[model samples]
Target chain A: MTDIKTLETASSPEKLNRVVIEPVTRVEGHGKVTLLLDDNNQVQQARLHIVEFRGFEKFIQGRPYWELPVLVQRLCGICPVSHHLAAAKAVDQLVGVDQLTPTAEKVRRLMHYGQTLQSHALHFFHLSSPDLLFGYDDAVAHRNIIGVLQDYPETAKQGVLLRKYGQEVIRLTAGKRIHGTGAIPGGVNKNLNQKEREFLLQDIDQMIEWGKTALELSISLFEKNLPNSRDFATNETNMLSLCREDGGLDIYHGGLRARRPDGSLIIDGIDYRDYEDYIHEQVKPWTYMKFPYLVAQGREEGTYRVGPLARINNCDFIDTPLAEKARLHFRAFADEGLVQSTLAYHWARMIELLHCTEAIRDLLNDPDISGTELITKGNMREKGIGVIEAPRGSLFHHYEIDEGGLVTRANLIVSTTNNNRAMNESIRRVAIDELNGRELTEPLLNQIEVAIRAYDPCLSCATHALGKMPLEVQLVDAEGHTVDRLYKNANGDVSLCKIEA
Target chain B: MIRHFTLDGKKIPFREGQTIMEAAQDAGIYIPHLCYNPEFVPHGSCRVCTVKANGRIVASCTTPATEEMQVENETEELQGNRRELLQMLFVEGNHVCPGCEKSGACQLQAVAYYTGMLAPEFTYFYPMRTVDSSHPDVAIDYNRCILCELCVRASRDEDGKNIFSIDGRGINTHLTVNSASGKLGDTDFDVHDKAAQVCPVGAILPKHEGYNIPIGQRLYDRKPISVVGDVADHQEE
Candidate 1:
């Protein structure tokens, strides 16, 4: 958890003279970083500050209990389904509806997998590929979807097609792709038909084939760049994920587990309802987002990462054959134990994508995919918690309701919040090691942004609706005199780039 | 005789045999709708005014008002259905929204625009259809018609013309001219009629004023039309 403090001149004379990177760039959401330096220009304290204020918690109060799923689903476009499912689970819990029938469970799992596959695929191919495949300083035009198509048309086409499959799965199961209407308190409202099942199966087969080829291409690219890419593997952080006791792949649903770099599970079967016990949230003066850290380890050593790398590290075995093959290849390079580096996360995401595709295929081919028993009737009475391993990390939704079925209380802890401590640590480490001796250039800035994006942080998901981030940087002299200052507007356009001796 | 029920937790009286929509309107709680007209017999085809009755969501336009029943308007499930229905309407129609002359005035576009539908979730079918410039004063573009049956309703109930009818099913179901000749000009259709003006999308555009009102100042330009209102008082019977 972050410790908020007001900077005082008398406390540390040397610290008064520092340079701060007020705003970070190339990210979806707004955040800042204060880099303190001594009189000798050496680094002092590096603090990553998230400076966006959104009150989704406060906004959702007094809303009808049943409406939460749709309301929360709009929280983030990238992970709308995650929020929807979590909200539904919470409602289900409040309604005292647990243990969905096999068919309903299978359909829910299918929908969940669709989101995971699409979201993970999007991050790997569109978001992260620019840094890994193309250089960080690649032109803006060449850094987006158009660029991907131009550079690798087949790969780009496959990515689009694969995403379509994932989206189609969501559409078929939920009735619509974005902000779907399927998952209710008891179960889903929509059911799949025979034609829809067949369509999904055919699409899944194509996606699986596409995923296999994409994996091979990605591995080859990584292999060719391994020696040069070694330095990218900088930050050493702890890993947290949801996994089974036997250490098999658990993505859609599972219990929480925390582990060190050596594959030793420190905390296992941590009930999501009791999440507040293991994780602690603290407020920073600059940002409304609460930084949550692992309580047992404390903030300094409590820095732990979640998402694909974390999941790969915590699990001993994978369910799918294709995923196991990818895992073997990944382990050959980074070892089988808990790998702490953020760069390895990309590989983990690819492995998971492969696994998700295979799993989706398996689920689609099941006879129950077209079952009529989709929604189960139930009454709302008891509070419940819904925990799922979203593509980015662990997602938890807890809700309390009155007997009348109106939501009295709702608490959501997204995966990105869980990685806040680790992200700060990673940023600091990269700043110290990569930026210490290097000149402040556009490439260096891009590298810094890439390091943060490596975790695939969903900033929009983190901060609900506080708009436009303003970035201000200040360089101070030994006497605490402002030597240089820079200001950037909400669109990340530098408004003032000035320097004073 | 009147039917009474709770709406959004408030109790109100509805006409004995009136639709839930009519009752809600009589109670001054406007339910968002597109197809239902007070003059027409309830069609319940659009599925936009779907509300929870006895814990199950159903179209309020067709469901009869019942005594002491609980009805939830604008519930999460209903909202989802409404949004999805709007999305389907947007994608299914040839509503080239930005360029349409009746964009603001069109009821289909009005409901969609008010609902905050920025993008269509489903893939655009982009079905093409020929515009019938057959009528002297009006043109019917089947592409942008959402099959809301508003035109059909107006023809049969309001104008007492019965010149419009719907054909097909599911996603393919669409409004067709009620003439064996299959042409608006060939049929006993008059462009000056209210049915022509009541056509929701640019599907039924005025032939003379094709590009007169810029898309922005169209149907919903001045104020939004209430879906349900005093329908009990305006009852045909």
Candidate 2:
């Protein structure tokens, strides 16, 4: 974006300023976007304030090691599978199992593909489609999945059915859709039945076709929104994701890879368990989420973007045949492997969606998917590490167990936190470029939300580290008498006067 | 002699001295209940089975089957109150279901499922409780205990062993063991004790039997808890 260079120096971490937009919708958890405007109406800084405290990291301390896999799944309703697998991977190490029974790994991989597919379908059709199909300047209420149903009825239905299919896959593999405990340490708890496998396979051909169509539609939408993408909140930053041993795209398991904006390699093929050696976490006073930066680039400048765009950029190729074709088309949009258009995330998201379906089809076709030998018994270890490419981005869960097998310490670097700094940068860039001296309309303010939504952040999971412990505010006049007062309830209901107040 | 009463607009027949719960059970109607086992003396501690008898709230397990009495069990108002009580029990203890071995089989969880209780209405207490794994054949996880006192009643009335009792009151109440060492292992409570099989929550579990059945194939898994036992027979009409 032309404004990206000018907005680079706008954010100063020292000072805090106030312009609040609360209850950002269509994404998970409680969050507010705050922008600090200078006297000249120029954007000085912007920040995403995630306020909810889950207390999982703190409360999970004394739980037994075997329980971590199932216990951690409650972190997020939408992305429980990610947490489930990540925690399972970590527990696998704790169980002293280098690898799982073949059937267990295959079943887990199949279940993971379902999770990725379902999440992408939800974002594209249910959340982002309304903004793309109906246009952003449309009425706020009408720019949702319901509006998409009214206009593009078939597309909306397809989105719903696709999500349902993905959910069914999860239910078939795991016990139930939300917080299922099928994925255990060393292996899964059960195997897929032939009847269930047949049922899922029946829809594969149609799902693949729908994936192609949705990806094509998303690419067309991106071209139409290219001007907006180029101008609005285009963040130029480093990229990070997980890649297969041969540098292929891997959503389930792989080695870590980071690339700079100039297509130079920051690090490649690094074991994610050794993440502390190469990555550093920086905390800000304003938000509960932490910013993760590369150790090589240092704090402020080391911030990198993750999720769909980053995954597509950091990987060399997609292993699935049809997905590889889509990847080739996506690569053309980049200039020497550097695509800075923040909006291109939607395009990359579609490619990943295609990849997920193909991956699911491939995993299900493998005969070993239905094999038993689900669990492996082993000696326990004190420390464990697990990492995987979550639908959002790379997720890591590290834990230490006591002699009694109770979890002593747990550290989670969730996907949303990895992109925290980049998300803020996008918001600041958009506010500076678009909101300069203009009366902030609903549509104009929505750009900041749109910029944040592109990351598909799950704030509830990210806010576990530290949170906005109940705050109250009172304004005093020059004479020191109280003029105004504000406070939040336990459920975070602020008695703010309605719009036009 | 046979006597009859009206429950939720249905005629239910009963014998003398039988409580409303017993009559309802005889008539193949399921009234949501816990801590009211037929084999043991009625210990109406869990309040989840409170129903309206003749326009007044009463525990059905203790209320006698009266002639032509109007008893309300499935009213939205009553169910709503039941849901609140269930929610209170959920938050009162550290009931972490995913970590529990008895999650799918727990009657408290099943009752919550039957009452459509999605989440606890109040904040989670996250109480730190001890696990008595000292017993060779049985273990007691105090976190999932709902303080129903069924184990205490079953141990004294059925098992003929005075190993379990209720101690303290109000929020400080807990299950107390009678042995000098205050552990299940030190007591005469065996794996075959009636008290061992009577716990509705995951409080007292048989050792070496964790996750014996996968989640989807458990007791509450096949038919939802609402359709289990007396609850299922009542759904036929």
lDDT: which candidate is best?
Answer: 2
RMSD of each: 18.0, 6.6
- Badly placed stretches (over 4 Å) of model 1 are A1-26, A37-41, A139-141, A225-233, A284-286, A332-336, A462-501, B1-237
Task: For residues A1-501, write the lDDT of model 2, one tens digit per residue.
Answer: 335434434455234224566656566666887555554445555667888877787888866666777788888888799998999899888878878888999889888888988888887888778777887667765777778899999999889988888999899888787778788778888888889889999999899999988899888988885788655678779999888889999888888899999878899999888998988899877678888999999986798988999999888899988889888888787767578788888888889888888888887888889897888777778989899888889898999977656678999999999988888888887787777666545566677778887887888843221112332333333244433344433343434322221
The superposed Cα distance between candidate 2 and the true structure at residue B27, in angstroms, equals 10
| CAPRI-style quality class for the chain A–B interface of candidate 1 | incorrect
lDDT for model 2, on a 0 to 1 scale? 0.79
Worst 10 residues of 2 chain B by lDDT: B228-237
Candidate 2 lDDT, B136-217, residue by residue in tens: 6777888888887878887898888989988998899999999999988789889888788778788887653355355778
Q: Considering summed lDDT, which 10 consecutive residues are worst modelled in model 2 chain A?
A: A462-471
Clashing pairs in 2: B30-B230
Q: What's the lDDT of the predicted structure labeled candidate 1?
A: 0.70
Question: What docking grade does candidate 2 earn?
Answer: incorrect
True contacts kept of each: 0.00, 0.21
In candidate 1 chain B, what residue range of length 10 has the lowest lDDT sum?
Answer: B228-237
For every model in order, the TM-score on chain A comes to 0.87, 0.90
lDDT tens readout by residue for model 1, B1-237: 655798889997987787789888877777878777776777787888899998888899999889998999867667777889999878877666543445455666667655656678898888866556556556677767878777787778778899899888887787788777787877777766668656546677654233322222334555554542221222232
